[model samples]
Target: MAATGTYTETFVELIRRASAELPAEVAEALRTGREAEQRGGLASIALNTILENVDLAREASAPICQDTGTPVVWVHHPTGVSTRAVKADFEAAVREATARTYLRPNAVNTLTGANTGDGSGRGIPFMHFEEWDEPRIEVRMILKGGGSENVGAQYKLPDGKLGAGRDLDGVRRAVLDAVVQAQGKGCAPGVLGVCIGGDRVSAFEASKRQLLRPLADTNPMPELAALEERILREGNELGIGPMGFGGSTTLLGVKIGVLDRLPACYFVTISYMCWAARKAGVSIGEGGELTWLS
Candidate 1:
């Protein structure tokens, strides 16, 4: 379970790429959303500024957003690999990335009210490890900002207030309600990752996991796919256009995931991601070769 210098450096590069560059599919979605907005409208202007910022960040090899957000990492590795070693290397890389200015020092001490200057705290860079049959190590990361994270919502089904039941319709209602509540606050023109069924904690985890999917991917389940489309269509129709400016481009994409729930609990969770939506992945071969995956 020893960390190698090469692995640590490669992880640093991975963090750099994820922090500085927006994924192509997400950028394309933003472009398409911009084009759909009225020419001289606020939505168009906001998207235009966003696109320019994306380009500037890439060109300068800098963090995409001022609040670099929390680095949430998922590691998939071969059975023989050591998860503890991987986590140690990842933590090292996160600190180095922070020092290099690719990430801001956002981690703070709750009781002391002090900033963890190196982005290392109790659970600053959250990591999850999974062992697979693959011979190589695959690391994927997403930088989730506090603003969007604050807007994430979880709802229990059979709620009388929203009239949501333990069904797909209920899920839809909950999602729309989240969007309405988050109008322009989660840095609008955002993406929604939803989980239909699970316990409270697992449902939120599954919802955030859905955000790792590509923006252009279609859900394997037909019903979920249709619901995704419906939410996207109806969300934009609310006139909560880019930054809630009243335009055609409210949401760029919607991803849904489902999990088994207990008989008594039907929880629906929604994770909202801002336009930045920064994520990246890398696969490290046994020979130390690296392959970039977006």
Candidate 2:
């Protein structure tokens, strides 16, 4: 089996689908969040509005959120396909997606403060490519919005301020602090993607990558899975509510990933995703059979 298709078009379709549709897992999470809220409460109303917007966006083929977000793409390719080619096509597709209004012109010149208008700047539309032994190409994408990005947090262990030590309990303390600080500012009833180890930069990267996982998927590691569940429970207890309106549905889910770190540094990085957790993936098999992933 060999690959056959217009790579550029397939890439553009991927972006369009990710931008316009809310994955079903995320939708289900929101449904659960809504049910958790008190009847006729602010959180309930907010969740209802969000659910309605999701439906409207899908039907109209419009972006689920006005921000459209920064495109974080990860490509896992088989032996023969060139990563350079995949990146080139991906960038072109991003530009096309922007021009066609599937994505907003989100990229800008940071120092000069100039908008690129085509969704491509020096480091905008970040991409990572990995070689795999499989016979298919898997492209995972996450459209992370600025508001949620603003709420992302990193913590160093042995911090006396919160009485957090260099352990999982410390990680939990830091994570809860982040949620409290966000206070519905990053769009309440959100999902949290956490990295429990790694250095500053790598921890943040790993945390963002955790957002690629579906909301309903469970972590393979039993300890991490338990921690995720506990965090979800405790964070919601803070009562940040939907949009910070103060309700029972503060967080929809928590996803955690861990990486080994240097002995001296203990870092916990959290990447927050708003209610509109825009993520989608696609796989092109050796026979060029395309599959959409949530």
Candidate 3:
């Protein structure tokens, strides 16, 4: 299907929704975490404030967080769709979103230390496009903030320092280490998206893709599912608490994905997502009809 002029407007709305609202599953996780904390403690207070922000952002049609991190999008289009045209629409939508304040001007020139102002620098909205058999175009996006991005970590296994071997246990150790190091810095009560066994770049990409999964969904792989649960349970016990205030609500959820790696490389990448967890999706029909996928 050919791209239409309406595609850009549809994408702008998608960006607005993603930036202004937290996903239902993520918000539910935060609610559950808040209930688990001491009612009058600092952790509770932090969670309460976060929830308030969520509500206010939605009500005001404003961004959930001031730092509307990078826009990372995944697009699944029909076999004959033109990726270049789709990308052009995405770029236009990003500029429109920035102008409307749904997204902040975040794209920066790495070497020059200058902001792009329109959120349209090179690779500004990092996107991945895949051809699918489906008739409609499906798009999923995540607005990942700078704080959480800063706390993301990658580890090479069989390391003596962490006593981490190239195994599931090593993966567990690396994820927990990332959490401890982040403390409250990644805007705790965070969620983790972990990828095991990919090369350095693919590892990080796969890990961030895991963040697009719903918080309540189970990993199809039995072992990975078990690890996710174990990590979530143990992570909350570390007393990192909400926003690093010291409590039992450190992480809201954990999602894990895996990729094949070379024998010499066993890389584990963890992408930390702050509680805002701004994610949204849409399906565009051939006639430009829109369906929100949340």
Candidate 4:
């Protein structure tokens, strides 16, 4: 790969400036989670500690709870910009970030996969890519914690169209299924990342990105927004509550992003975000950048 201009970074440099921003947002969710806990839901003391750790991690430049997940990369390339030489540029950024951040190397070989334990090599950080309109390369990074990733899932619905095929009810079923299946394993109370439309692949991407949005943010689309509200309402009603303690707040936030699906396939993906939600990402373009996120 021929080097042009490279913007290299460590996780430390990606979100540090956003530190002041992440807490208040997460605290709001914490308060809500606690309230639900009071109402016989979200029995998540583990989750409480996780959120506390996020705040502490930001102040300390720590890994934000050891899972230090497989790196998720979102790449936006401008039109006419050929990425022909960007061999795993996304992966490179993640590796560089991991190495610099001193992330605990966790990748291992499947057949002969060695832990190598150096924060490099296969599987440590999973790369998810997107090519969008841009002149310069734009990369976004999220360290997807293992606990949350373990809770990720997708299911097929008949006729694959949003609002037509599975409808909102189907989505609720999937959410509860995910929560019940996790059973305090992935750490709770958790956030729900959902994708209602698109084929299998796009749905998965939507679900993953749902984790990237600020935890308390809202969808602008009216119907989609309504669905988010109802899902949040019912998801809390699950009684899985926090950390499997029978309560009203099993989920922290129900974040969603939808893609219009083709008639042939509809996919509902549930990406679980454990209490830590220890995800940090970067944006470089018109906006300035920072590391050690909120």
Candidate 5:
């Protein structure tokens, strides 16, 4: 696969690593969130499970859970690359892998809402794409589960400052309001990602990217970084804690991705409640090759 300049190995690794590693972060957060219920002791349990799961998954290279989630695939095609047919071809590769790996199928016909007979076990892995201003192809897959997805919300904001109506603080308030409304429903002890600019589509795109930012990386802009930190702190203070069982750690992190919007409306898109944030990513090469993730 490497000799062919394809990303096959990376793709395979994505599946294998996700299976094993996902449980650690997921279970730990859940465990800790649980402990937090009573002085947040249950948090230890989640943390412990996280530690154990990673150890076990590494020793036994398998998926963390059977529901590997919608395969959020991001592909960046370089300037010189011809992607006219790349998207369709990659979709085919996904189907082939699903069958071989026996991944749960997630695609359904909207009109009929019926399942397609494939290795996709009814509903599983989803694919999203974009062309980058680069020459190399970068593909990432996030096996996002469904439980946390339900808590997402969007708002155009009433007299939003972005629309030259009020101030930026309104957007922050909306975020807080959304999280509070979500409560423990989202399987707390999670993360909050926000998209603060662009139209509906681009704003959502920015929000999606926030989920991909490495957990340890800091925002280059101090203002944005501080805002993220504040959200994480304040969000945790909400007491939504693990599995909604009740705890102090309502969120593991808060990531905000923003782009300058037009002088119309400040669109805010929030994605939340990653029960365990069970996601994995990988890279794919040219000529329709795939690589796995770690």
Candidate 6:
């Protein structure tokens, strides 16, 4: 089946919006963090600079961060639509976005260490597609920066070093340790997306995908929800503050996902995102109307 120009245009618009604008929820979290800091302090100053940068980027339609990071797309579509066609449309959009500077040339060759000037290289703009019963198509994109990406961590259950066993308490230990280890390197105050159980690769993928969730939304699982809250509170208590300058606020939010794993393996994965937190989604109807979601 042939993809329409409108579809391609919609993809381009999604890229532009996701690249250029910080999502509303993330922006609100930043504002709240700024207000929570002590007046005229280093943390407060850092937050002010961050908020200013956010406003300028949005107003000018420029990338919110120097490192545009990686484009990870999740597409949920009706069964009849072609996944291949959807991918092709998105790849074309990425090329156009790069030419237009919505994205920098971020695709790097793993072995040769060469940059893919067009932002389309082997495995770049990584995509995940799912078939759904819903008639409309929903596309969600997260631009995860390299700085925060560097701080992502994974832990095995029953870790002797931390005295963490294969349980909820253990999971909490691992998550908090990750935050302490990251310090200001990942660009605090940051948001964390975590997965409780899964194999190595799937665990990391689920952790990153959890970042798509809104900062204000609580997890349906009461246990997980409470853990998220506790993590956020304790992370801030670390005094890593904004950009690690030291202050009251260190974390903006925490989101967790759980997946069942094998009997012998228990894994916890942490995905860190800087305050920029560039994420946005759109729903495209069959008639070509677009609805924005965050």
Pairs clashing within candidate 1: none
Which candidate wins on lDDT? 3
**TM-score to native of every candidate shown:** 0.97, 0.96, 0.97, 0.78, 0.77, 0.97
Question: lDDT per residue, candidate 2, 60-155, as tens digits?
Answer: 889999899989999999888877778778888888999889999998888989898898888777988889999999999999999999999999
Query: Residue 143 of model 3: what lDDT?
Result: 90
Query: Between candidates 1 and 4, which one is better according to TM-score?
Result: 1
Summed backbone clashes in each candidate are 0, 0, 0, 23, 39, 0
What would the per-residue lDDT of candidate 1 be over residues 50-73, giving only the tens digit for each residue? Answer: 999999999999999988888888
* Candidate 6 runs further than 4 Å off: 1-6
Residue 217 lDDT in candidate 5:
67
lDDT score of residue 181 within candidate 4: 81
Candidate 5: global Cα-lDDT? 0.63
lDDT of candidate 4 at residue 266, scale 0 to 100: 63
Over 4 Å off, model 3: 1-4
lDDT of 3 by residue, 116-216 (tens): 89988998889999998889999999999999999999999987888899889999998999999999999998989999998988988899999988888
Model 2 / residue 162 / CA error / Å: 0.9
Cα misplacement distance, residue 3 of candidate 4 (Å) = 6.4
CA RMSD, predictions in order: 1.2, 2.6, 1.7, 4.5, 4.9, 1.4
- Judged by TM-score relative to the true structure, which candidate is superior, 3 or 5? 3
Candidate 6 global TM-score: 0.97
Off by over 4 Å in 5: 1-10, 23-60, 100-102, 119-135, 159-166, 283-294
lDDT of 6 by residue, 1-294 (tens): 444455687888888898888987777888888888899999999888988888898898888887888889999999798888888888888888888898898898999998878988888789999999999999999998999999999999899999899888899899999999999999998989999989998998899899998899999999999999999998888989999999878898999999999999999999999988889899999887899986
lDDT of 2: 0.89
